[model samples]
Target: MRTQEGDKTVELFLSDEGDEVVIEVADQGCGVPEALREKIFEQGVSTRTDEPGEHGIGLYLIASYVGRCGGVITLEDNDPCGTLFSLFLPKVKKNDDRTINPIDR
Candidate 1:
C-alpha cells in the first residue's frame, strides 16, 4: 500500500496461473531508466552509485537459474515508482504433468 505522506515500500506476490507460477517483486524506490533496464541485468552495471561492491550481476544470476528451469523472466516499470521483476515458471507436476512447458525465447 502507498500513501501520499509515506515513502514507497517493497512488495512481493506469488500466484498460480493455470499451469505456471507467477512471481512478482516490486519496490517503491527510484525507478530504472528505460535505456538502462536491460543493461541492469548485465554484470558491472550497478544502479547503486554510492554503494561499493555494486556488481549488476544479481539479476543475471537469477535469470541464469530461471533459464535453466525453463522459465521466462521480465522487467517492467511499476506505477507511481520502482521496477517490477516478474517470473513465470513452469509448474512442476507429479505423476502426470499436463501443462505446457515454457520455452526459452
Candidate 2:
C-alpha cells in the first residue's frame, strides 16, 4: 500500500477456495498510454530513453516466465492514475492424500 507519484506498489492475494495466487503491481509514474499497451510486452520495446542501453525487456520477460510456469499476466490502468500489472499462478496439487513427502526425498 504505497502512495507515491512515481513509485511502484505490489500486493499479493491468495484465494481460500482454490490454488489461485494473484499478484498485482501498480506504478504511479507517467502512465502508459492506451495505444502502446499491447506492444509494451513485446521484445525490444522500451519507453525509457533517458538511460542509455536500457532494453525494455521487463514486461516481456515477466510474461514469458509466467507463461512457462502455467500462469497468466495482464496489464491494465490503475484507478485514478498509472499502470497495474496482474499475475495469476495456479498452485500444483499433490495426488497422494495419505503421504505428503518432498519430491526430492
Candidate 3:
C-alpha cells in the first residue's frame, strides 16, 4: 500500500484465485491505537479536535459503503508507524454471448 502524510495512499490488488479484490490504504500520519480500532468506525468518532465544521465520519462512511458493497474493511498498524486500512471486495460476474454457446436442439 502507498504511504503519505496529508493524503491517503491506496493500493489495489487483484487475486488470481477466486473473485477477491483487496484494497489497502496506508497513511504516515498518527497511527491508530488498537484500543480505539473498533470505535473508530462508529459515527461521529474522531481523534481530531472538534471544529466548527468538523464531523468525524470518515471510517464510519468507509465501513458503511464497504458493507453495502458486500465487502469487508479492517484497520491495522503500519510497520514503523502509521495506520493501514484494508478492504476486501468480492468480484462480480458478467454473462455475455461470448461466455456461452447454444446447444443443438
Off by more than 4 A, model 2: 1-17, 94-105
Q: What tens-digit string does per-residue lDDT give for candidate 3 at 1-105?
A: 333434555344444446777887776657876777878888887766534766667788778777766789988888766777888976666652222233222
Q: In order, how many clashes per candidate?
A: 0, 0, 0
Tens digits of per-residue lDDT for model 2, 1-105: 444444555544444436667777776655677777888888787767566896877788787777766788888887776677888876666763443233231
1 against 2, candidate with superior lDDT? 1
Q: Model 1 off-target regions past 4 Å?
A: 1-8, 95-105
Best by TM-score: 1
Q: What C-alpha lDDT do the candidate models reach, one value each?
A: 0.79, 0.70, 0.70
**Candidate 1: pairs in clash:** none
How close to the true structure is residue 32 of candidate 1, measured as C-alpha lDDT?
A: 78
Full ranking by TM-score: 1, 3, 2
lDDT of 1 by residue, 1-105 (tens): 566557568889999999899999998777778878867766567677776765776787777777767798898889978889999998776876544454344
